[model samples]
Target: MRAIAYFKQNDIHFSSDLPEPRIGADDEVLIDVSWCGVCGTDLHEYLDGPIFMPKDGETNPLSGKQLPQPLGHEFSGVVAEVGPKVTKVKVGDHVVVEASLGCLDTHRWPKTRLSCTQDKPCGACRKGFTNCCEHNGFTGLGVVGGAFAEKVVAGERHCIKVSPDLPLDVAALVEPLSVSWHALRSAGFQKGMTACILGAGPIGLTTIAALKGAGAKKIVVSELAQIRRDFAQSIGAEVFDPTAHGTNAAEVLKKMSGDDDGFDFAFDCSGVKATFDMGLAFTTFHGVCVNVAIWGHKPVDYYPMLVTCKEKILTGSIGYTTLDFESVVNALQNGDIPLDDCKKLISGKYTLEDGWEKGFMQLMHHKDKCIKILLTPNNHGELKSAK
Candidate 1:
């Protein structure tokens, strides 16, 4: 199996001879990966990490693993093998993986259906919020070998089948799309409501798609990058160039809304202090502001009076639930989301061998031009052009 593994901070290497994973339990499923999307988290680990890669001489408390781990979580594939007890999917089925690894003892399996027999459940899991389970661990980051290789072994509960007609490359986006879907659900989004997204990166773009699918009356996206702003507009979002607006982006959003009421929901996907403040300021009184980006360890400073004066609902969303994954799959399959436009998000593709230079570094340097870069174990070809 060929894989990209993290050995230390600022180091990830492609290994052609990595051992192939096997199904170790009755509930496990082995997938022959077709496409894996490189994520911001992977970039974070590559540039300044050991953040989720587990430090040297230490083990992840959830998975009992250490460094030299595979690096990909957003992926889709065909089922190559399934344990005897796995009934959710069969061999040759097209599927996407939900890589969040919740505590086995307290977390329920098949979260989409919410079936559980545990006498006591974790605080979050008990409330159907498994994404926030007290002992959450991401499979690709450390808990299990990821889809960076030819074969990935994951629990059946984490695998969701997609329409065979769905392009495998586009299917790889289910994981990230679910992240935005969960954020919308967390903010109590509803039809006819106005929302603003504070970034035009992958997550921000997906948030726009999700908001559109949810029938938001007005969708405003604020971004500094012209390429991203154009991409957002192509998908029917009214975009604002933050660089042009300077510190008045919030006021601009309010003016665009035609009333000073502000957006019903505002999302901060940029993970910066300034964007966070803008999201808060753009949200209407009594409306919700959802933090969808992971800030790592960086601290943010904001006026407490912002929340106090407006009676705003300030909340943060982590990973997505199984339902979110299922929702995205259905949206793609049923045409609620425009497939052609959604395909534009996949800006590049590379083989496992070229993932470091052409994939990760492309995002690291030319982020304005690259959106979601997919790395395949089998396809070593030219980069896919954006639609």
Candidate 2:
């Protein structure tokens, strides 16, 4: 199997000898890769990482898997094979993977060191918050070889079957969209609410589509990049550039909520000090502010009074669960989220053989001009028509 693999930090590349995955458990599923998306986290691993991929010599805590694994998590594919107990999907079904691995997943890898040394489910998982598991990991990051390869084996529980009517390329976007959907759900976002999303990057753009599907009354995307702002606008969001308003930017954006108070919800998709401050400052009394972005080790100064003064709620959302994937897929299929708008995020497509140079490298060097770039193994005959 050929795949873009992570050997160590800064050593990721395309390899033709990566071992092909197979269904190892009764609930396992083998998928023939159709399309996979290059994610920001993948770039982070190639640059400053070992963040999610285990360190140079360390193994993943949950799966006990080491580095040199394939690098991709956001993906869609056709089922190739399934374990006897895998009833959720069958061969030929098109699906998108949920991708998270946690304490609950230890049973699937019964021979793992953790399974033998520490088998208890994490407190978060016991409480039904598997996303916050103490040893949370993802399939592509380290739990197993990922979708960057020609084939991937995911647990049936992690695979969400989608309508065959949905293009596999568009189905690949569901993983990122599920992240935002989980964030909004965590924040208690409601239909007809005015929301402000900070940033228009890949995750930010998906946040807009999630909001659209969830029925936001007014979506205001604040971004510094003109092109990203335009991308948000094209997805039916009202775009805002805070640089023009100086210190009063938050107040100005609040007025756009139409309440003259503040946005009912504020999402910080760009994990920067500016957006952090703006998310807290621009939300209404009793409003919710959700942090969906992954921040670096550096900490930002916090003022409890900001939220205390107005009774505003501040929370953070991490990875998604199966529910988010199911919801996003249903939204895309039911006409709540326009397929064309979802397709708009795809700026480029490349074969897996050239994905490292043409897909990942393109985003690394010229990211501002790109939104989402997808890679394919070219296994599906539909590629001729799908392309």
Candidate 3:
């Protein structure tokens, strides 16, 4: 087997002949990688170094996989093998693996359903709510192997089967799109809402597209780059050049919308403080502000006063849940996401042989211009391991 492994923080070496993963338990299944989408988090790991990867002697206690593992989460592939107890799916089934891997052994039973669903949810698993499962384990980075390499082994529960109509390359987007879905779900978005997204990158655009598909009356995207702004417009979002429009979204909105009032909902997808401030400034009174970007620091600021004054909702969104993932897949299957336009979202492509620094670094520095980049096996097979 071959794979792209993290030898150390900020270092990904390419190597072949890595041992192929075997079916660990009766509930597990192995998938042959088809297409893996490169995400912002992966680029963050490549640039900022590993913070979430498993360390030696620090096994998940659930799947028990160890340190320096392969790093891929958003991917789509075909089932190549199944464990003895795996009956839901078999060989040749095309599936998209969920990035999360919870402690299913404890939560699988109906009794645990109380802890898993709303009311007693502890903030995450509550019916319409649910971000990160506090009690559950992570799938790709923690408990199970990810889909970056030639093969990925995961519990059957994490695999979502796609209709044969959905191609593998397009299916690879299901996880990332699900992330946008979870963010919107967390924010309690409704139809006819006008949203101002403070970033036009891949995730930002995806969020805009999702809002449009859900019947948002209007979407205003704030982007600093012309390419990103153009991309947003290409996808049907009304774009605003925040940098050129004088640091004030109110003024920018007036210039963009003539005399329209503030937007109904605002989302900060840039993960930067400046964008956060702009999102707060442009949102309508009593509107919601959703933070979908991953900010490493304490996201606290004076925005609370603004939030309090307007009685606005301030919320943070995290990774996707099972239902969110299902919604993403269904959205794709129904053509609500538009595969043709979704394909255009892919601005760059790379092969694993180029190594992480080259491909991943490009993502870090040129994010304003690049949308999504897919990392394929050199031969379009398994990803080679680091040297």
Candidate 4:
């Protein structure tokens, strides 16, 4: 098995002789990975890692994994083998992994759901919010082996069957799109409402598409990159260059909203100080502002008076739930999310050998030119589109 592993901060390697994983439990499924998307967390692990990767001397209590763990969470594959008790999917099913690892053993009854059933489950899990389970860790990130390899094994609860007609590469996006879906649902988004997305990165772009599919009446996106702005526009979103938008990007959003009003819901997917402030400022009074990005210890300073005056609701969304994943898959299958537009987000492709230089580095330094890069293990040296 050839897989990418994280050894330390700024250290990741692709090994051709890595040991192959096998199905060890009756509820496990082994997948032949078709495509894996390089995510921001993967980049963070490469540049300033050990953030999520367990310390060299410590172990992840849930997965019991130490350093040098396999690294990839957003992926899709074919079920190469299935444990005898795995009844939700067969050996030849095409599926996208949910990736979020919760109390796998306790949440085994309903294969389609990922909830804890312990007498005293975590507070979040008790509320049916498994994504916030106290012991949660991503499968490829720090729990079980990841999908960056040719094959990886995961519990059947973490695998969601998708339509075989869906392209495998596009199927890799189900996890991230589910993130956006959960964020909107958390913010109480309703049909015919307006939204303002404060970024044009991969997640932000996906948020726009998800909003459209959910029946949003107006979608406004603020981005500094011209290419991303163009991409947002191509998807029927009104985009503005944040850097050139007057003194503050919020002003642009307010004007766009008309009558000096603000949007019904605003999302901060940039994880930056400016974008966070803009999302708060541009949200209508009594509206909701959702933080959908991972901010690594970045302190933000803003007027608390603003929140108090508007009676605004400030909330944050982490991972996705089973319902969120199913909704995105349904949207993709129903043609609500256009395949051609979704394919535009994929900027490049690479093999596991060149994933470091071509995939991670491309996103790190050339973010203006790259959106989402896919990597494959069996398809060595193949750089064509995953579509």
| Index of the highest-TM-score prediction | 2
Going through the candidates in order, what is the number of backbone clashes in each?
A: 0, 0, 12, 0
Q: Residues 1-387, candidate 1: write the lDDT tens digits.
A: 799988777779899887888887788899999999999889988887877777887776665656777889999999999998999999999999999976552222322122322455567877878888877778789667788889998888889999889999989999998999999987799999998899999999999888887888999898888888999998899989877776676788777755588888889988888888888877889889899887767788888898989899999888998899999999889887778877888888888898888888888998888889999997723457433
Error of 1 at 40 (Å): 1.0
Clashes of 2: 0
Candidate 1 residue-wise lDDT at 27: 81
> TM-score, each model?
0.91, 0.96, 0.86, 0.91
Which stretch of 10 consecutive residues in model 2 shows the poorest summed lDDT?
Answer: 378-387
Ranking by lDDT: 2, 1, 4, 3
Who wins the lDDT comparison? 2
Instruction: Give candidate 4's whole-model lDDT.
Output: 0.82
Over the stretch 1-387, how does candidate 4's per-residue lDDT look in tens digits?
Answer: 788988777788888887788887788899999899999888887777677678778776665556667789999999999999999899889999888876644433333233344566778777888888887878777666787889988888778899989988888888888999999987789999888898889899999889987999889898888888998998889987877857765776777865367888888888888888888878889878899988867588888888899899989998898789888999999988887777878888789988887888778888877788999987733476432
TM-score of 2: 0.96
Deviation in Å, model 1, residue 175 alpha carbon: 0.7
What is candidate 2's lDDT per residue for 1-387, written digit by digit as tens?
899889987899898998888777789999998899999999988888888888888887777677789989999999999999988999999999999988777767754666422256768888778898777889899879888989999988889999999999999999999999999988788999989999999988899999999999999999999988988999899999989998889889988999978889988999999999999988989989899988878999989999999999989999999999999999999989899998888887788887888888888998998888888887553332111
Superposing all C-alpha atoms, what RMSD in Å does each candidate have to the true structure? Answer: 3.9, 2.2, 4.7, 3.6
